[model samples]
Target: MRHACFLTVGPARFRIGSDWRAPIDQLRALYSDYPMDEVVPDFTVRLQATSALRRFVRPQVAIAGDFTLPDAVPLPLHHGLLAAEMAMNLQMALGWRRHLLLHASAVSRQGRAVVMTGVSGAGKSTLSALLAERGWRFLGDEFVLLDPETGNIAPFPRPISLKNAAVAAMEHEIDDDSRFGPVLRDTPKGTIRHLRPRTEWIEQMARETRPGLLLFPRFGFPRAVRRMDEAESFVRLTQASTNYVALGERGFDALTGFVRSVPACAIDYATGDEGAELVERLWSETGAGAGDRAAAA
Candidate 1:
């Protein structure tokens, strides 16, 4: 059996298996991995993935391979890189609660979670990167978890993926060479990197926050920011969500609850700087405040 360890983005426990190890030695060596101060034990999630294709079916958790790659053909590391994410989505879809699977980039600040759902070219990654750089807690660039019961969002803490022009922007912004991993060549999207979030935040990987805002970010001319109605937001979000149709009535209830509770907006910006400022203003507007909210149910 192959052995590897990962820190997932939900509430569960410290899981163990013949194929994995915990208290990640490399992560510990690089930086002190400590739990968040306001630790919520109940929200913690720990699980293992034994199947490759099945692992890529979810949102939050990811997997790492121990086997050596041949020099001739580059392995599909990114697909494998997101195994945990796939697992998270699968777990949520099958779990008891009804959640609308949204295709969005999500993050947290103060105490609230914000999801930015958009199509492939809609600057979701760029916006997410901007938020992460501007002190917002990174939830995910590709997936966001929403709790059906309280209309709150859960953390899907994983690496921030940057592609094409976004990569250049990040390279220009950060000084540290170690902050990024080796650039992979020829992905369907483009060349990419697994961006490392602040070590302090990574230590708090087990932490989950509530859903406070939903935004459909668009990049184009006449740059401006506008608030979207909850009803319209719900429609768009439902479409972007991964397993909305699969979850049925329970999923609809969860989505409606989320739309009602969280403020939804449409962010229009051409540049990352403007996008970052818009998010900052939104964060301040929301009552994220100082302390963390209770973890999702």
Candidate 2:
């Protein structure tokens, strides 16, 4: 806990303390666009050595914070940056109660947001990152914050964690080298790197957008789109949400209202390009309908 840094992403502020300075330095450089001023943090994460001897020997970083998994394995010192990121995610997943936390990625355009969620490797993260590079404003690449009372989407705008093929794909899409973090190979989810979102999106993190569309995207498949019903979308989202049951009735009301309000679809695409195209087409159709429905209501 000798080295520490404060980070504010959207509605959450985090204080990450590390046993070594390397992780803190990495965080500072990557999150340079974010608000790092000293403030009361919503959550705290600690990166400590696995053992007293490990601090001097082959140092290993263990995730310790307000909420932690007892069976979590420690990462080597070289992967301390990833460990810090993971620790922050753990804290948000278990501790955050201000909003309904959906394990999804989101993007906004014309003041309306699209929420995408699916299993890991489902291409939601990649799709959101790709759209961010395009005309869409990146809201978040991890958790989509849904205000329980208003049912609006709060932007998280954390760095997008690109894994395996995604890392290279984004590198090809974005020419700027300064926006990417160091590559950490052979991690839990394979080779991983962080892509810093556009500075404008980071600066606009506090702005919230109305939900326009809900997508469940699956990658590496032939292109297809299926309309999803409210009941099914509700059940799926309950599974996708990290703190749904923890929030109890408030979570249920928020989620039900969300599914009922937005148009839901399950999209499958073989490549990132196709995925982006699918989203664009659907938004044109569904987004217009959302506008009409809002007017009618």
Candidate 3:
């Protein structure tokens, strides 16, 4: 049997048969126009589509050993495909030994990249949109992959996911022409919007950037900017990182190395203007202003 489904996150390919009783062939019979690829032996998954219940007479069929979620809803939907795509992207990002994946937003200016690491409510997306509007190149809004070997950051360049007040904050920062696409209303995270990527940087979306500074930004009162010591910064960063649980010992080593090698700080502010100024000051102090390369070791 043949079946075809495409995902947006990574490589757009799929094959629906081989390990399971020729399901792909059955699919091909129904939809001759759909494309098909021979399923690889290693790619195993169980079949649990609602439609399968009528054909197999079993509640679920184990496809290639991976258990598919039981189908109470519908069959042949894109949920599995979507999950696979996300997994693939996650795998690809983690595959690089040179990179330690952090949950953050990254932006580049004058060839230097600054990564902002924080939790969901930590103003990362807001700061990222603010920086992009001010002519800084947007690397990514959620994931910052820092190369351990070269100390450079690579761009994942996914859509900038913003929530609630951030939407208004971004609207105020950018003109209508520069606004990213449209605002998505009433998302799970509360009225979300995805800022479209800058087209000029699309080709270089996967390019690596040298780590100039690591920032932990927060939105709060009594705003203050302070440079943190390496140890303190490392502690805070470890807490803020996303994939640290998966990285384990290797993650620890990479995080420690990064803190020691680069300048890290915490910026507390209530507005984008202060955040932008703090970032600008960091770049200037590091000697990475326009037309200037960061000072060499």
lDDT of candidates 1 onward, in order: 0.61, 0.94, 0.60
RMSD of 2: 2.5
Model 2 worst lDDT window (10 residues)? 287-296
Tell me how many residue pairs clash in candidate 3.
10
User: For candidate 1, lDDT tens digit of each residue in 1-297?
Assistant: 344333334443222122233223323332224332333322223333435553445422233222211231222333433333333344444342334557788878666777888998788877887777777888777667666666666665556677778888898888786777557667545676667777766766666677777778887645777888878988887788777877788778988888887777888887888877777777667655334333221
Q: Kindly list the per-residue Cα lDDT of model 2 for residues 102-221, writing each as its tens digit.
A: 999999887899899999999999999999999899999899999999999999999999999999999999999999999999998899999999999998999999999999999999
Give per-model CA RMSD.
8.4, 2.5, 8.1
Return the TM-score for each candidate structure: 0.69, 0.97, 0.67
Clashes of each: 22, 0, 10
Descending-TM-score candidate ranking: 2, 1, 3
lDDT tens digits by residue: candidate 3, 1-297:
333332121122233332234443333332232223453422333343435454445433232223233332322222232222233334444443345778788899767788898777888878887888788888888777766556577776655666788877776666664435344454335566556565555556656677777888887645777888998978777776656656777778778888876777788887778888888888777644544542432
Positional deviation of residue 61's Cα in model 2 after best superposition, in angstroms: 0.3
Worst 10-residue lDDT window, candidate 1: 65-74
Clash count in backbone of candidate 2 = 0
- Residue ranges of candidate 3 with Cα displaced over 4 Å: 1-98, 176-182, 287-297
Cα error of candidate 1 at position 125, Å: 2.2
